[model samples]
Target chain A: MKQRFLNDTNLLLVFSAAILLMPIWLSPLGAAYPDLLQKFAIYGIFAIGFNILFGLTGYLSFGHAAFLGVGSYAAVWSFKLFTMNVVPAVFFGVIFAGLLAFLIGYISLRRSGIYFSILTLAFAQMSYNLAYSVLTPITNGETGLQLTINDPRWIDSMYITVEEGLPSTNLFGLKMSGYPGFYFCAILLIVCFFISLRIFRSPFGLMLRGIKSNQNRMNYTGLNTKPYMLSAFVISGMFAGLAGSLLAVTDPLAGAERMQWTASGEVVLMTILGGVGTLIGPMLGAGLIKYFENIFSSFNKNLLHEVFSFLPDGVEDVVVQVVSLFVGGGWHLTLGLLFMIVVIFLPGGIVEGFQKFGGVFGYGKNKNSDSSPQNQAAE
Target chain B: MDSILIQILNGLDKGAAYALIALGLTLVFGTLGIVNFAHGAIFMLGAFCAVTFRKLLTLSVKVKDESVTMFAAYKDEPYLKIWFGDTGEAIIDYAVPLSILIAIPFMVLVGYAMERGLIRHFYKRAHADQILVTFGLAIVVQELIKASFGANPIPQAAPDIVAGSANVGLWFGLGESLVYPWWRLIYLCFSGVMIFAVFSFLQFTTYGMVVRAGMRDRETVGLLGINIQRRFTIVFAIAAVVAGTAGVMYTPILPPDYHMGMDFLVLSFVVVVVGGMGSLGGAVTAGFLLGIVQSFASMNEVKSIIPGIDQIIIYLVAVVILLTLPRGLMGRAGVMDD
Candidate 1:
């Protein structure tokens, strides 16, 4: 009981500290920086949601982006029809994504392994093509949907007067254009994190673990596992939808590219790299990858030349050339190498690495021992 | 009618590529139970091989004509400059055809190395791990190719003898309407012969029987004292050769690009899945069928009704077939149900 209390207090303290530090760290980077952070946070949330379905259930979905794309489209439509209020748009996005997941997951979960992967992939590709062509009016085709100056800001106009012909969205009079958007996304992420935490600790989570370990045994015990799996699938889809809604809220744009299988694969990579099934790992993975993509891609040879200016002319040229190979335009090479090394050496991901560190520090050894039996029983 | 014929021809060519790649994927999966996501990268490498060969072939020794007399200058015969250069120069002109021969062994070796080095380690791991590791390897291979070849598509022209189209309509008395490129025809015939050879090798030979047995039950074959893993490695090499050959032949049609592998990867996997996981015949058949359907769907007439149907046709077919026949068209019974 005392240990449980300690855990709860530690969690609360961590939460409070994170909330306080976000603004402090973000402030120095200025307003535009938070937009990117918001994107990272949103994608992190999506990856975390995906990890729940994939990491726990062992279902490698190659179509999760379909839900995200659908959610974004739904949010954009909501913004178009209903008030420019973010809440209703987000809510509708989650519902629409969940509904779509329910339909697809029902058909897809029937098959397992590579077939399941192929099925999800096929579905996503179908969606992508459909959006690119058949659903062009809805998805806006390749040009993508963008908020125009003519969009009816029903609630925003009534709540506060903005200059005519200006493009903007407001959430209960709070502008979603900058810092407010980041805070909004961060709050959503914290909420999602806590909900995922609850679900992970719940009995349902234990049963899902059982289903993953041995589905036949679970069935033989007379437990109806389909509903449970479906529930998990829907919940995960909703989380992805939330992330999608946040993306649209920040950017007010939706593109069919969001539903591409590569985007889905990116989330999978993030989950695996950060440590699948670990709560904070996917978030860390998303942040790290996005940071590298945003920051590393911006660096050019001129910057490299400046950094290596102290070196001799010939040496500096060689150094700059070599550094450019690994840095500018060759970011994917570095990412691929990182992925290969991580998968080969640390298959359990960064979470496992952290756990090993904790073990070395003598903090997790006894904790793991006590948890092993419970884990085994749950499995 | 003319448009229909053209679409059919286009589809057949595209289907030829899909069939070749899907055949390789099915071969590896059937023999080794490994879903190789890197098959497309191998295909791309094959195209690069052709490109490299083209580059190597174009190397020449240029000499200046020094004769000043009107008749003598006009009749100047350019002699090959020799600094041990004639021998190297002669080899360059025949590089493209020679690359096909060279690519086979090179790709086979790559296949063998890849199997022995990375993939062999993951034989005991989960399918997810296998997919992840292979996918990672695919990305690495693709990026490496990009680093070497740059991002743009490199055109690889066929030999002058087979560069232009053959007028089949002349023989048919159709006013020279049915003109097909000679190189494309050669590719089709080559792919056909190669497919036949692969089928014949697997069907008629004792080694093929052993491979079939191993595919059926690896442990049973291992217990029978046959080294199944080594055979699997060979099968992987054979699959690589097939994909590389397809890539070599396809370079003229689609030009070689680093990202070409990624573009085909999803479609090829769709073909493999639709063909049934371990069924080789199914893969070939599905490849052609989807290829034809995709071709027909891309027609202007079809596009009027169903916009971008060509892009989604294969995937739609895959989804429908998977839903209807969960085991795929010719998947072994009780294999995919789980």
Candidate 2:
């Protein structure tokens, strides 16, 4: 018990130190900028929550983006009706997404395997199409939901008055944007990580692992699997919701595109790329994909030229042309190729690759203490 | 009543596309047990095949005009027209139909390559891995198309002879106004023939008999010393060809775009599930049923009552069917639902 507690403490300490000092580590990778950093933190939370349901229970959802979009819409609505404070907005975001997840989860969990995936996908696409057209009144159609200056923010109007246009979201008086916003997201991410860790060690999480491994044996042992699966689904949905709320809190806008199936595919890619079921793997995956999205996609021909200026004139032109294909408008091609390679060659993802490399080099843990939970989850 | 008739006509045209794609999907699923998310990408490639054929037929040569400034002011005379006079013009006019000749061979080769190179390796992997890999392939295919053709939708019109609306209302004693596109009717007829041909091929052919036996129990068929694996490969290629032809025929109705495959993929999957996984007949039936339901829901009266019914009717039907029937309308009891 003492050794286990020490291990947990060590893990938490290391994780906290890494996240808190992200500015130091991320700067070298050119992702320490505020917007990208916030994205990393937000998508990390989304992936972590997704991992709980997918990695643990092996229930692959193709509609989790619905909850994320719902959360944003709810948050934006809260900001419109109530105070500009993020607390109420985030609260409503989580609650609304939780309710939506409950409804979708109840109907969808009736089937498993590809059937479940299809059901979730249908629900998500239905939500997306509705949001695009029929629910235009609530979602603002394709224009998206945004805060207006003339609206009756009942509590904000009564308590505080600002003369310089629409007010930004705040915790107390500190603004939720730029460096401060990133730190706020980072702090929340740490809390989320700790909670996920606790769940990983808990009996409830063990039952989820059991369901993933062999639900038949679990059923034969007299365990009701539906409630457990539903709970995980709702919890994960709430995580997506919270991330959505954070996005609105930072930017104060919610678009219908946020709930698109492609967005859902992206999170799946992130979790798979980072190594599913491992506590830190999803966060790593989120950061890597976000880094690619923000940094790699922005590399224009001019930027490429500037970077490769040291090369000979002829070689530089040739290099730039080839490198340009993997970035900018061709970024999706690169991403698709990378994704295919990873799924085919590294099914367990980067974490598995690292472990194997370490083992081959005799740098692995001597006592097999590094027999990661991900390995068990992958089985 | 005329409006209702027109709506039903519209539904059948849309349903034809759905049925063709779903039938192809079910064939592969039944024989190979692979949930091919990339199947829609095959359809997209088919549509592009027609576009390519048109482009090739209309390849223009710049002729200098002495009235202006050399090549700066030139006349674009198509090489085909210059080479063969009216014959070249006629070929360009009939490019969409003629493209079927190109699509079949190209699609067959693609299907064979996919099965032999990538899909055959994934037969023993988990369903999640299969889905991911195939989805990845779908993305790569679409991205390549986007790189080559650009992101905009390329509109292709039917030949001038069949371009106008056919006044079906006159036949029904409802005046001359209730008309439908003639090409859509052609599409519906084409899909019907294709589905019938596929069904007949499977029912009468000895190769198809071995395939059915393999679908029933692969190990038992293998025990009898038949090369079931090779036949399954051929079936995959056949499925690809069917999807490709369906796409080629659909180009006149809906413009070809890089993302069209993804749009149809989700809807087609819903059709497959509602029809019952692995049941070809169920797929065809459900495709038409959902298509009609969608058309009906989009009517003003239905929209006023149900609001977003058109947007969700297919998925709603799928959910209801899956919940109530579990195995779908004609799905085998233990194929995918455990």
DockQ each: 0.44, 0.53
Candidate 2 — which pairs collide? none
Best by DockQ: 2
Docking class of 2: medium
Name the docking class for model 1: acceptable
lDDT per residue as tens, model 1, B92-136: 545566688879988999999999998887766667777777888
Candidate 1 similarity to native, TM-score: 0.90
Colliding pairs, model 1? none
Q: What lDDT score goes with residue A136 in model 1?
A: 85
Across A271-360, the per-residue lDDT of candidate 1 in tens digits comes to: 888877766778878876787777677789999999999999999999998888767788877777788777777777776777778778
TM-score of each: 0.90, 0.95
lDDT at residue A49 of model 1 (Cα atoms): 95
For residues A287-307, what per-residue lDDT tens digits would candidate 2 score against the true structure? 988888888889899999999
Where does candidate 1 stray beyond 4 Å? A1-9, A12-16, A23-32, A153-162, A308-316, A366-379, B1-5, B60-95, B168-176, B334-337
Scored against the true structure, residue B308 in model 2 reaches a CA lDDT of: 85
> In angstroms, how far off is B44's CA in candidate 2?
0.7
